[model samples]
Target: MASAFQAKGLQYWVSELAQAVLPILPGSAVEIRRLLEHPDTSLNQIGDLVAQDPVLRLHVLRACNNQFAEKAAGTLSNPHHCVSMLGMDNISALVDSLKPDCGANNRFEPRYLQAIIQSSHAAELALSWLPFRHQGNADQLVLACLLYGVPDWAMWRVASNEARMIDALVQQQRVPVEEAELAVLGCQRAELAKALAQHWHFSDQVCGAIHGAPIPSPAFLMRYARLAQKHSNDAASVRMPNKTEAGLLAHSQGFTVHLSNTLAQQSARSWYSKPTLRCQAIVAAYLDQPLVRILELTKSVALETSRRFAIVGVQSPAEGLLWPQPSAQRRRIKPSQMDAAVTKMASMLGQGSVPAKAPKSATPAPPSQRPDPLNQPRAIGIKSEKLPDGLDHHAIRSAPKPAAKPAAVFPGFVSAEKYADYETLINKLLHQPSAFSSEQEALRSITDCLYRCTELERVVVAVLNPERSKLEAYYAQGCSEAPALQRFTVQLQPPNLFTQLLRQPAATWISRERQQQIEGVIPGQFRQASQCEDFFLMSVFNQQGAYGLFYADRGLTDRIGLSEAEYKIFKSTGAHCSKYLMALQP
Candidate 1:
């Protein structure tokens, strides 16, 4: 099946590989397995343990949900309920299943081994350091760190050659790992990992960690752990760049960095069971040692770990590890040598240095005969003739002036009197007994008011289903008889902007600038069907939670700009609708 998918291409094979390896636990999962061995462990205790790690919780819930689909009344909200439903025997079996077969050593490749080692080191660091700063379960942090490199392992399993090529490109070009992966595989590894997590029903927090944008706490810890591991294992000094490279440097100075480094130092100290030369070297690197010294220290630490661990029936720490090294044959190809070779090549080709700057002439030639300045090659180190004193040369040959920007024509703002009138109208609508008779009627009245008062080309009201898991279009106005709004039924799960808005009830003005920023969060189908550039998202809620949302938008070419007054009015309208909705409820 894996080979068949691989033949189809990266998209198919990567997903298949992710699914194949979903149940394969990292080396750190051994610790969790050890805890599950005791018979006295309660469901709550096991739940807590599983919940700490997103992957573990996901595995448990997925198994439980699949096994009890018909019997279960609702979706299992947490690990405790899932474990309770599955029972200890089933839970034990699930844990045992996650353990890699001891007999299957031949299946583990060098890349897989390396990823395991990296994950173990990161998990150790997280377990050691994450607890001191926060009261949350430390085990979850450990699990998150352990699974941080899952994408790398999955990629290697599916496309080893492509994975190696990506690594090489990242090193050679000094580009980001994700960017290099995108160049080679046509998709970011992190995005693939997130997709897999989502597919397997991982918790939102865990999925977000895999995504790594807007870095959540767990993801942040994993990043630091990876950085420390890289520094310790690599022979070359991991030089911290002077300036923060956008999208590259995850941490500058914060609690997360400080805690990660502290944990890293602690993990290093535990390596030898006593404070030794290697331990000091690791600590010094964490303390921000000079780059040259860090290189030396890291090499010593790697050598020590390899020598000590290899003696204890463990694999050599640095065995088969690829580390960037300083070139030893420094004088083999100098800049001078390259220049000399280039000069000899040019001489042999009978080409002289750039034709002697167009021979200077006393008088200017006719425009037609003279070379076009735009077309002519610019001469190096040659200065143009100076203009006569006070004769502005820049102004004489300046480029054409840019066109003026058109004034905003959209009716987004309202005068003080007009705003007062809008407020009065909203109040009147809210107090009207006939309007509040039914939820549908209230929604219709609200949509009608927006259509009449605002410059919106379309307006829609989508009501949450009874399960609160899906939203369906209940009302729409303007644009056409068969409104495009009907196509936008949104699922509350696998959260998008609509779901997020429901979670935090608010009125959002989706300006053109913001629309681009949040394109990923907005439903692609809705974006395509509506073909609207900017829109207003107003979430309606009662004490029970967000029951519906009102969407208003202009056409694709037009912009929707709302002032503070207009925005407040939109909010009040939504609020009034919410009040009427609650009143209609039994």
Candidate 2:
């Protein structure tokens, strides 16, 4: 009788924690809980969720063992064991913990739930920005950011017109979420997220991370959330109009150039780039609309996109080419989360009617349509995005800006139709552009092609100067489009402080103080922001004699220094640019 009472009392308390914790956390009950209780959930991945408990293993077993209690035919000899012992249904239930609905029972116009959903999605999208930097801790960073807006639910019940603030900020203020978040919420989402994250007894690091997110750290997944909402797909050149603004966000968050471009391009289409899908999906579901219908809504699309991109890889952390993981499976952005967010939106229109864009080959506007973006919320075709030039030149030379991006015409899907043109252009530049008279000419031609094809945001080419044994920037793009920047060059000096590292017969990084010390020793190496932050490297070569390095704007993309995966890309880009430069040499 005493043992039975203990079991009952334990069950009751566990239920209390589940009820209190589930509604407060982000992600579906199935998603967050799996990550929370999953033993296989790495020490690194989902640190925000699992790191909370002093005894996570105990909790994992507890959750799993107790899961089947309600339906168990008989008591197992040793019930308190691993999740594998529980049936899949019970295990999944523990993972898919449902809140006992914090039922206010109030029907809010425009639906308060939708705003809550969108805000959560926006935070998730911010978290989706991890992969590009390839930072080891990227996944944890993402969860921290995704959970940032959950605390604002406290404010949601007070805002009478829930949708009004989000809508007005986007349409009238031209806020692309982060800015609007600043405008409306008065603080970055990271702060709000950290506050709630702390309230829930998440890892102080997670709380620290939410606090640390807008600042810098190599713990990238959370850091990149700062850049989740704003992404532009073009990388061959070195300059972007908003690169400066992006860099500012990065520095404040603590990212270096290494991550900027890598994350930026990766984020362009991947859901990992944003977390909005979950928020929007949840909002849409609560509003009672089909998944497809709500993603088509635009009133909060920018925020939605941000949310989608930020959570790009919350599932699988540390995925590389060597690993086969969910993040690497290459799937379309899932609207699984849209189910709930859509319900919130649907509730606003009593009839459940949503604004959808007209299909192609049909008139976009109806005769009696109000001049509202809301009325035209159907997914707009991503245009051929024209990139304008002539504003900035990179470190090496002055050149015309990459041609302006044509208006973007997005294909409906990521099938061959969407990537074909980019692939075709790359093939042309890769194979046929070798006929230039000199490497310099070859470099120019390649830049022009990359720009016209909208393949690169910036380009840099360097050759080792025999006398200095250093890489010298020969040609560069997307930088100081000013005539002066075109003529500039910085010596990729060998590390004086990193002498031991350089002597190791392999590539390596020295200490930061040493790197800074050695940099001061270079004659022309006075520091100035390159790609919007101090980005100077002491080239350390491995036995392979690899030379030259490239980085994107610190705030604009990911952490700098090329990875093995990108080295292959650089080889191709470098080979083509070298040929271009050789042809132009007098």
Candidate 3:
């Protein structure tokens, strides 16, 4: 089959592609097969396991979405829901039909495996970044990025030699990637991806992400332009988007997915690469945040990926920061490609013209005077303050960065203490100001009060960073059972529950009934990451306003619903903690 398909170009590959052209990780396949054999295997278990392997994840989503669409039902993007819809028999059959290469006895090709790992990293990065921009359809975005390299993966499975040649020409010979793909594969990788997407009947959004939207003919473009202009001129005239126009518009998300993929791949190579910096610059401009802040975020997401996924042979991006890889050479893009990228980015963001190029004869502006899009004004409700005539309070607060003190050791569980007199504990913590040495210690004591006085099993105090854009977990108690709470971080933009609370000093409790009522307002990510419902959140404010919040839950057990009395005490404790925080501000 390999010999028959050699250099057959895009159409042939699309038409003749084998059913199992994509390769799942050998280890994942074995584990999945083992689990499927078990009589009590749950859909959630399979979904969680399938999530680790991009190949299997795509298979499940594609199969479920296709099945649902055939019945005129909306498609399913959530993996667990997909698994449930397919049923156990269908999933078992699907797993059984995987290629011989998926057998655990077979070894993975290094380059092919690298591509899979990179795609996984990209998906994780995209999912982690949803709160910042597009919070809706988070799962769909992850699936899109994971499947971005489907064409390449399929080629690696069926045509390893051609794949090797393309990589060689691009990496070893330093040829432009598009030129290299054309020379070796008889078509660009993106074009092949687009063809395969169509052949498999992928959704237009995914199809757009695979190779961008299909290029419209000049006649089609002119007709659309005329319709748009006529509608703009006449309020009564309706500008309807036909099938072609809707398909074209659906692919705008492709650029965001592409940026995620670029960052994932380059960060794995080296954090300091020119391509990496360029990607970060683009993101910084989009988010209206400093380039340095974006760089820090890049590192943080890479660390999160490493913590989340445990793929073999692939080193964590954070590892490169410590023992720098000698082989991790920075790859520079050709000027032609770089210019095209900038122009495309400008047009995609609705900026019609490219940034004007500075003339060589012109004196270069100083870094301070130069136009930096990242340094633009903050979004509404996020204020920008000019530096005052005194010492910078922001700098003073951040200067004494210390290692996070470990979670305080508390006595063993006490009986019948649930919702007991918390007034004494709250008053003691409030009155004894000198009892705690640092701001974090004070917060930790108050967090422990919930565990000691209330039936709540988990408590976390997340403080705002200096920029006040995110709340990072500063202290926690009763979170040993749920480690996700320990690393809890919440972005304070894009108007989520956390952002709304930060608008002013406020306290809110989400009981089971309340969670159902406001489910739409609560971000899917916060639900997934916090891994709780029926929780308590009380905002703590300093003089500057909206410092942080206290989060508590009954743990995953949810055996006991949080009571109004406990909520009241939690609010009072948070209030005193806010006073302590403000007192230490100077």
Candidate 4:
């Protein structure tokens, strides 16, 4: 079965796969299917069992919806409703059509298991969000989300070899799954899924979403509005002309399912990955909530989905969240490098008693109380010869400094050619003056230039609040995944770098050398927010004087240094933007 469709087109595979018997169900679903052979099996009892397994529920819904297309257009009810709609004989027939072999050795592949779990999570999220969107067929959308990855699961089972190769390529080489799928299977999974769903007569809601049909539920409408507003400040609400209320309702419902499925699919990757973050941001915008709230909702849904679909030997997104292992950058120290205290502690524990209190000479006097590090008073005596850790301070100070390594480029580093291009674009915009029609456009343009033309990983424009008591992030580039950077704010109650910038239109560069000098006046909150000590700051002023601040920096772990050239461009960009703002000021 796996080899039959090799080197074939999408339509060929769809037509062949749709008619082929489905692979054996997951272990849990297979057990539930076995109960169907019992002569005393009741429809209600079978429905309850089927509802417990996401895969089994999908099979039942697929069968029922295919048989009753009209009824499926609206919200299809629970498993019991689908079971009653399809008599016991039809249910048994559906199970029989599945590949017959089922054994205790049957184990789900990682890709297949992840797809199932992710789809389940997506379905749960759709259902959870259903209450917020009253215009859609809630049940239908949830079903669509649940069955969204049906094609992926089916392909993995029927084409194990190809799927394995694709998975290995994606994981080991970091190649995109779509690219691997195209190379190995001769077509992308999405196109294949759409064709297969259509061939199998799946519900139109699921099929349309896979086919990329636009359904404008409230969430989708909100997503559209957010994107529109992101590009233009005065973006108005999007309206569809000549469409009746019913049509709009149907569109919205379809889009809701589409977006839910999209978001879930991306969840199989790191939650902080670019695709996932973008989807989360869209969801956050739609819900009119913070990104943190959206993250919490998704995590909660993943856990609930894991509980509802308890598949053994399979790790779900919930597990990833609950017990995240350390990253490569945070690997545990090797045992051989254990400190003296750690080694002593281990030896004492092995003896089951504190190794008979140290000898009198070694114990010396009672242990001195350590000063409160955060509030320790400065010593007024001559410098100590030995450090607190008992190291000779003079020897350590005299040791030759380690040779400095060349700075490694940050992940967001722009190439020299790209920087030149950005610089050219900025220069044109500044010289032409008519290139930007609004003050907002000019500000966004400069923010973008700083991000692309310099080594900065993030560039933010924070505007003063109406009361002029604080500065809040108004626009940012390269900050979507960083909630802290997105929420950049600084209070002006006390004198600080930001307050000084606002006092007069001036630019300040907090290089490594300057950080120590301004450390006292630099706001602690800004340091916590930006997570970078060295950054560029300049006041943005119009005819009304300083009203905002321009901030830019390499990211949290940036190894690169801010060059003088980059700082010059940063300041010049701000100057041009300020000039534009003053011209536009009424």
lDDT leader: 3
Model 3 per-residue lDDT tens digits across residues 170-214: 443345677766655668866676667666656666666657644
**Colliding residue pairs in candidate 3:** none
The stretch of ten residues in a row with the least summed lDDT in candidate 3 is: 323-332
Candidate 4 C-alpha lDDT tens digits along 77-104: 4688999989888888877776554333
Comparison by lDDT, 2 against 3, better one:
3
lDDT of 2: 0.36
- lDDT against the true structure, each candidate: 0.53, 0.36, 0.65, 0.64
Candidate 1, residues 4-42, lDDT tens digits: the string is 111133466456665654334344376567667766767
168 in model 3: Cα distance from truth in Å?
Answer: 0.9
Candidate 2 C-alpha lDDT tens digits along 1-586: 1111011122332233233332322333345565656667643443334332212222343454345444545322122234446544454464445453333453431233433334434333333433222333443443444344343343444432323444433322233544444443445544555555444445554456455644323343332322221211222111112123335343222232122212322222233323433333332322233434434442244444444323321221112112111111122112342233223323443232346767685556675764766555453222324323553334223444578877655332123453455455456444433222122343444444433343334444443455544545555566554323334455445453223322322232223345555655433442332323323232323222433333222123545533343333334444443333232212
Candidate 1, after superposition: displacement of residue 4 in Å? 20
Q: What's model 2's TM-score?
A: 0.25
TM-score of every model versus the real structure = 0.33, 0.25, 0.47, 0.46
127: Cα error in model 1, Å: 3.9
lDDT assessment of candidate 4? 0.64
TM-score of 1: 0.33
